[model samples]
Target: MNVTTGLFYVFSAVLLFAAFRVITARNPVHAALYLVLTFFQAAMIWMLLKAEFLSITLVLVYVGAVMVLFLFVVMMMDINVENLRVGFWKHFPLAAIVGVVIALEMAAVLMGGFRVVDDPNAVAAAAEANNAKELGKLLFTQYLVQLEVAAAILLVAMIAAIALTLRARKDSKYVSPGDQVRVRSADRMTVVKMDATQAAVAPVAEVSEPKA
Candidate 1:
């Protein structure tokens, strides 16, 4: 096989392994780490396919930001693995069925006999400008509303996740922004004034110098 094909196979193998580990790992942190590896491999594959914009975005956004956030959240959260695994066996059959269905769907897609044919005209057109620039222009002009909607949905999902993971402990202290904004100096501190009296001082005891 050619070098490109060999590297593709290698990346694909690692990607599959990392993806499998992401699902099967017992620890959430480990799963997140594996997911990061999966993202990296996918990004590399994209790079190989000359999709530099998507590859860089996948690395920067997902691997750098999202996966890091996932790792931190997974690490910080108190996840009871034993409790979570309690019903795994009970749901195994359903999970297996779903997995099989997905596998069959993928197989159908693979069997569709898709081929990539390089068009010289398209390549010549693309050579005039960078793909990222073209993609940006298209997204901003043609898909602006869809893009904004997607961003809004992502924002909502982020807020929901934060709300869900938030735990209110009895000992936990929370400061309200509204209360802070409304706070007055009188509420936080007391200013007391005392009158000063004339001092009657006779406390100093003077000692005579000892004879050398």
Candidate 2:
């Protein structure tokens, strides 16, 4: 086999292994780390495909930023692995069926993609072209509506997350900026004035001698 094909097989093998470990790892942090490995492997495969921009973006965005955040969150969370596994066996059958169906669907799509023939000249031209510029052109022209829709969905999701996080809770305390800005000193403190009173003095009883 050629060097490039051999490298592709090696990367794909590692990627699949890492992806499996991502789901099967007992510790959340370990699972996240495995996922990061999967991303790196996928990025390497993209590099072999000559999509340098996509490969670097996959590394920078997912491996560097997203996976780091995921690791931090996983590490910080107090996850009870045993408790999480309690229902795993109970739900395994249904989950397996769904997973199989999804895998079949993906296989069909990939098989179709593999059957498509590409022109060598066009592939060479595309390889020589600026990846980011071409991607931008496609996003703005052919996929403009789809891109805008995706952005709008992301915006809505962000707003929804903020709303959920900031929602008032009876068990939690929060302050309103408007209330703080409009607060008056008089409302916060009150002083009562009273005349000073002298200290009470105890009366002294004259010592009665034994009357003797």
Candidate 3:
């Protein structure tokens, strides 16, 4: 009925549509673009919830940086789409079941959240306070260990991903910085001493004045 509620419904619909497209789109680049749209819609919803910091962060970090990198990677990689879809039908049932379970869990959590009542004064205080400042306080104070653990886990995951994807190819050329730093000019170039040889002269038969 209200403009805010109308906007929320519109954004939620777009977010759901974009999210579906992200998973179902055939082209990886198109999927990534759809995911970016999904993030943007989610960010808009967060803005409507008055979480400005989260909204901006989602836009800047996910849409601006992460999605751009993902798009570039998808574009650059030689992915076989047909090969990827080979077992789609075989996996569809299990995937659908898992998706349904997750959706149910999320719905339960959201329903619980809706049922919980918040103090009006506390809500007003929270709304008045700086979002980023309050978030930082909570992160550093109560959830510091958890935050550190999450960061460590993310770092480990990044390292593992790099390790798994990295391959030593025999055909690919790579220069070792240590070897380069330790290289010597003498090792790089060699001068061979050799005797200078004269050019060979071929004997020519003299033509006797064109046989008058």
Pick the lDDT winner: 3
Tell how far residue 149 is off in model 2, in angstroms.
1.6
lDDT of 2 by residue, 44-163 (tens): 998888788899999999988988988888788888899877877788789879989999999998888764447889778866898778888999999999999999999999999998
lDDT (C-alpha) at residue 160 in model 2: 95
Q: Candidate 1 on 1-212: residue-level lDDT in tens?
A: 99889889999999999988876788888888899999999999988877899999999999899888888887888999878768777887898799899999999998887666499887687667677988999999999999999999999999999999998989988999999999998899988898768767779899999998
TM-score, cand. 2: 0.72
**Top candidate when judged by TM-score against the true structure:** 3
* Residues 1-212 of candidate 3: C-alpha lDDT, one tens digit per residue: 99999999999999999988877788888899999999999999999988999999999999899999988888999999988778777987898899999999999989877644478897788668888898999999999999999999999999999999999999999999999999999999999998869877889998777665
Ten-residue stretch with the least lDDT total in model 2 = 109-118
lDDT of 1 at 97: 92
Name the runs in model 1 displaced over 4 angstroms.
106-113, 116-119, 123-129, 154-212
Worst 10 residues of 1 by lDDT: 122-131
Clashing pairs in 3: none
Model 2's number of clashes is 0
**TM-score per candidate, chains pooled:** 0.70, 0.72, 0.74
Question: If both were scored by TM-score, which would come out higher, candidate 1 or candidate 2?
Answer: 2
Write down the lDDT of every candidate, Cα atoms only.
0.89, 0.88, 0.91
Q: What is the Cα-based lDDT of residue 48 in candidate 2? A: 88
